[model samples]
Target: MTVSGKTRHRFRCRYTSMPSPTSSLSSSYRNPGGSVSSSSLYHHASYLRRGKLVLGIMDFKWTLVFVITLLNLQPSSANGNGTVERKVHVGFIVDTQSWMGKIVDSCISMALSDLYLRNNHYRTKLVVHTRDFHGDPFLVLSQALSLLQSVELDALIVAESSGGVKILAGLGSRVKIPIISLFAAAPSLSFSQHPYWIRIGEDESSQAKGIATIVEEFRWRSVIFIYEDNDSAREFLPDLITSFEETDTRIALHIALLTSSTDGDIIDQLKKLMDLHTSVYVVHTSPILASRLFLNAKWLGMIGKEYAWITTSMITNFVNSMDPSVIEAMQGVVRFKPYVPSSKAVRRFEIRWSKNIDGNQNLQEIELNVCMVYGPMI
Candidate 1:
């Protein structure tokens, strides 16, 4: 009726060493009167007791009866009965060291947890494995390969803001694994080129219309455009130019700032723009570069009520995460951001996320697109 410590250890070893269910049941010994088997006793002894044992049924026959009753009480993976649960392994590759990457990782983790916790009938457990690329392209590829080969992930979720996503998407296609992107938004990485690639971020081209609308509403006939020299910005610039032309808004000057641009280089560009008579400007670049440009502009006294500064969604998406000084400099700047609906689920998620990254003072807001895209996919 009671299993000793040694007996319990022996039972565990035997149970673990046993072959598949398809094998013969000769290893199992059945009790007298066809009441219960040794296997059933082992199952009950393993789970029924807590820290201390209190067996009301001291007789072996009664113990066998209780074991049968408890075994039947176990939950089944299937809707009916006698089914095994399936497990899915998913990989996340992102720059966890960065602020935005940390936010994305947190959102993905919360999404996976919410999904499995709410859906009991799913019968599929999602195991998430994460790797930090540290914002390096080569590291991203290497880590991705390791996930594919070693981890054997069913799918991959990548959050990146660089040009390396094309290579990453290609690798996902080559391995026939779905690559869900929460950050990359270049139109060139469309579904046709890489069928395995799925983007949740808004396409850069789509924001061109919004920018044009803002320009037309303000009656700005001509405006200077400043953008980073990256694939997304370059691809977006042409579309924005076309949209401006359609709306009869001429782009008086277009400035492309390299990521490695020095302060002098930025100042030189700013000086040129300052000399121009056009007071309206449209800036499309990363949050870092945008902050730097605005800080320089503030020092030059260009960011004022007289100068109307309009930015695309790229800068607006990370406005809250920018430095206080940078935000102050661009106080009068106007931007159009994607709207996120208010819900109890979102509010709870926001509170949880805020606590997760509480130590990170740099990240003040969550990127809406990242949260939006993950909502439906998970």
Candidate 2:
């Protein structure tokens, strides 16, 4: 099930939704607490559901906010010069409690810290003001307006596919300040029309082509598309579906599970999918939710030689930081890794990011947004 309005119509034009499977698997597995199942998968799913899957980022947010800035922010006055560094007031609106929000907050802070360290001669310093909109569109608009009026914000950063984007884009156009997205925005947010709106990440069309190519190579005739029910997933689906048509692949089923779905709810939906013969499933969700999904699927016998799984870059980018159990459950899954150009500077930034994480992750840095943040600074 997908969302409505123009997007829904566009998606439906290319999709043939598999016969509404078993009415949500009859939702019969719900427990007295609604989700506190005594099963092994439930334990893992619960941990992830609490937003603990991202590990260090959650615990380190406060430290990043308070301690990292102590890396010595520049005062309004430049060192030993009559000229002052222009403090560009930038506003960041996100749900800081969520997985994506935490990363954006930390990445921007680290990226800025790194920026000032090497380029000491830079004339402009970004002074960031963040507001947690708690995933509410109304809050996004309100917080955005507050930041604009209170701080005289020179620019705004928000999730490209967030519900708040349209609202903020309108505001940014009126104010004539840049509205930058944290990651690659989908096709819908055309940059041609709205010059102030900026998207940073892998090109959306290229991402779609990559996903379709993978599926085509694997010869998965009809696959199940499972994604988190969010603005990002909605924005991402149209291009992917179109790409599928070019590859002559059919979407047998597409299930949009809510970001807040509990273990029982998720398991019930997975059970419904089992009724279908389709053995391939494509998942597009955050690492936390996707981890939880895989754990439950493995426990339900969905992870095996008979089945194959593919994940979008959203989940793959952060898989290095996921728990061993979650990673174990994801064994043999295909992932679309976002490509970042290799250079000494990129390598240096990756090393610094690894150290800042207390060595919890040794893999290459996947914070495309970090590179994106550097754009405004230039």
Q: Whose TM-score is greatest here?
A: 1
| lDDT, candidate 1, 1-378, per-residue tens | 122121111101122123343443222322222332334433554442232211111133443353234334444455346666555567888887765676677677766777767876665566778889997867878888888888767778787757778888898789987786765356566678898876655545445655565456446678888999977688777778876877877999889999899889999999988788787888888888998999999899886545767677677767777777887787656565544445696677677777766777666454444344353344
Angstrom error of the Cα, residue 66, model 1: value is 44
Can you write out model 2's per-residue Cα lDDT over 290-354, one digit (the tens) per residue? 98898999899887656667777677767766777887777656566434445787677666656
Clashing pairs in 2: none
Model 2 misplaced regions, further than 4 Å = 1-81, 135-137, 359-378
Output the TM-score of candidate 1: 0.73
lDDT of 1 at 47: 47
| lDDT at residue 222 of model 1 (Cα atoms) | 86
Q: How far in Å is the alpha carbon of 289 misplaced in model 1?
A: 1.9
Q: How accurate is candidate 2 locally (lDDT)?
A: 0.61
RMSD, each candidate, Å? 27.0, 13.6
TM-score against truth, every candidate: 0.73, 0.71
